[model samples]
Target: MSVSSVSVDLYSEKQLQQLVEEISLRFFDKPFRHRAFFNRRLRTTGGRYHLQSHDIDFNPKVLEKHGMEELIGVVKHELCHYHLHLEKRGYQHKDRDFKELLKQTGGSRYVQPLTERKVSYHYYQCQDCGGMIRRQRRVNVSRYVCGSCRGRLVQVTKND
Candidate 1:
């Protein structure tokens, strides 16, 4: 189902909870008894299922970037984990039960990687050759020199 046909904001925490419950019933023939909510802090993953609390957390970006269909897919993926865990079955991603249930429920095997990683690079420029370098670790300009020309290096910019 497309969000375009629905007037309400589908990514709201309450709406997510209702959607999860509905999907759980429809696909798994089981009720989702735990809470479901959007978690802005989820960066690389589309959703998370907490074993201790039986709660599900979804990444809002799934709805924003891929729309309701993808969000529903993620919900189904988490539900696979949720139900399997509650039933004392194999719930880990690498387990046979997880793979089988995920396939049976039409859940995504893996969430698409985020378009961008949350990484920052320190950039430097060679004074002599004008060559540039990018590194995850900050370089000491006084100690490190350009490899090509052995020229002094200067900080350029920090890129996100």
Candidate 2:
């Protein structure tokens, strides 16, 4: 399904659980007996499958940024780990069974890397002392003087 059509903004933990269960049955031909929920704390990972608890944790960012298709791929990838581990098959990323199952189910091999937010800093340099200064917000060069030598601060670069 298209990411835009999934309406993930309103999705809750219950819906996430149901989606995982549905995907498990549809793609793996097995039932997902464990729980699945959105983990807002997940930063870089798309999803994580707990080996001990058998529960799945999904990064909400996946749905927010990548959409439903990417979320489903992540679900499938976790499911591959879930089912394979339970069945005593190779479940690690380096395992043959894991690779084959991931390929067969069309699961994402890796989480799509999140775009890092860049902070633009205004750069200033002292005209007399040559001291460098960086500020998040623009500073009035005429009013603000260099901290080191109290010299006139000149705008060196707008952003970096």
Q: What is the clash count for each candidate, in the order shown?
A: 0, 0
Candidate models: Cα lDDT each: 0.86, 0.88
**In terms of lDDT, which candidate is strongest?**
2
The segments of candidate 2 whose C-alpha lies over 4 angstroms from its true place after superposition are: 1-5, 115-160
After best superposition, candidate 2 residue 70: deviation in angstroms? 0.6
Model 1 backbone overlap count: 0
The C-alpha TM-scores of every prediction are: 0.70, 0.70
Writing each residue's lDDT as its tens digit, candidate 2 over 120-151 gives: 89899999988889988999988989888899
Clashing pairs in 1: none
Task: Note the residue pairs that clash in candidate 2.
Answer: none
lDDT of 1 by residue, 1-160 (tens): 3323543354566767778888999899999998999888999899999999999999988888777777878988999999999999999998999999999988997777766767788999999999999998999999999999999999997555
State residue 58's C-alpha deviation in candidate 2, in Å.
0.3
Badly placed stretches (over 4 Å) of model 1 are 1-10, 118-160
CA RMSD per model (angstroms): 4.0, 6.6
